[model samples]
Target: MHVLTMLLPVFLAFALMLCKLFNSLRTMEVQMGMGVVLLRYESPSLFWFVIAFQCLVIGALLAIIYCAFFILSNQVMS
Candidate 1:
């Protein structure tokens, strides 16, 4: 459980970094489907915001889980 607390954030950070790096490549090819062009891309600021939000949410969840477990375990001991 404690290992997860450290790994979760690291994994999120690495995922975000990889996404940014891939987006930087700017390798979007035009796709024509049913006479409609489809293009998918991400802006740097949007990417950054996503990463930041993910970190925030994950951090909060971990804190909450930690607190709940700690309290429950202590109560059991008492």
Candidate 2:
């Protein structure tokens, strides 16, 4: 019971961090779009789309890695 109380908060914090990371990356993509439109003077939307899509893919990979890290670490600790 005591172990769970301590670990629960840790797990929640880790989860929140992952969520925030992804959200910030998404916001970055939006900002990049605005920058391209206002500064580049090019119809490079497809390029931005690909870049943002890569970010999305990378985000998923990071999430998977983060979860796996936590799980393995918790297993080792126990």
Candidate 3:
């Protein structure tokens, strides 16, 4: 329940995709017409506000990973 609340606004699409994929793998009864997928969530403001910060954090992490991989690859070649 808490996870649903937290992910409702920001990761709603991802969560729904996961749900659909999981449902297809088995008969979880979560299958419904695509039109019925409503995302009427509370605290939308919280998700909107956090989106930018989350993007920055993810970007920073990716940058670090890229740098680390580049350095390691250079070392391997030398």
TM-score rank, highest first?
1, 2, 3
Best by TM-score: 1
In model 2, what lDDT does residue 67 have?
A: 67
Whole-model Cα lDDT of every candidate shown, in order: 0.53, 0.53, 0.46
Query: Residue by residue across 1-78, what tens digits does model 3's lDDT show?
Result: 353364345455545555554543354232236754322144445433444444565556555556555664477543
Steric clash pairs (candidate 2): none
How do these models rank on lDDT, best leading?
2, 1, 3
TM-score of each: 0.40, 0.38, 0.35
Per candidate, the number of residue pairs that clash is: 0, 0, 0
Q: Which stretches of candidate 2 lie over 4 Å from their true place?
A: 1-43, 75-78
Any residue pairs clashing in model 3, and if so which?
Answer: none
Residue 1, candidate 3: C-alpha displacement in angstroms: 41
**Per-residue lDDT over 1-78 for candidate 2, one digit per residue giving the tens place of the 0 to 100 score:** 454564565566557655644554555432344454222224356546655665676566556567656765587553
Off by over 4 Å in 3: 1-46, 75-78
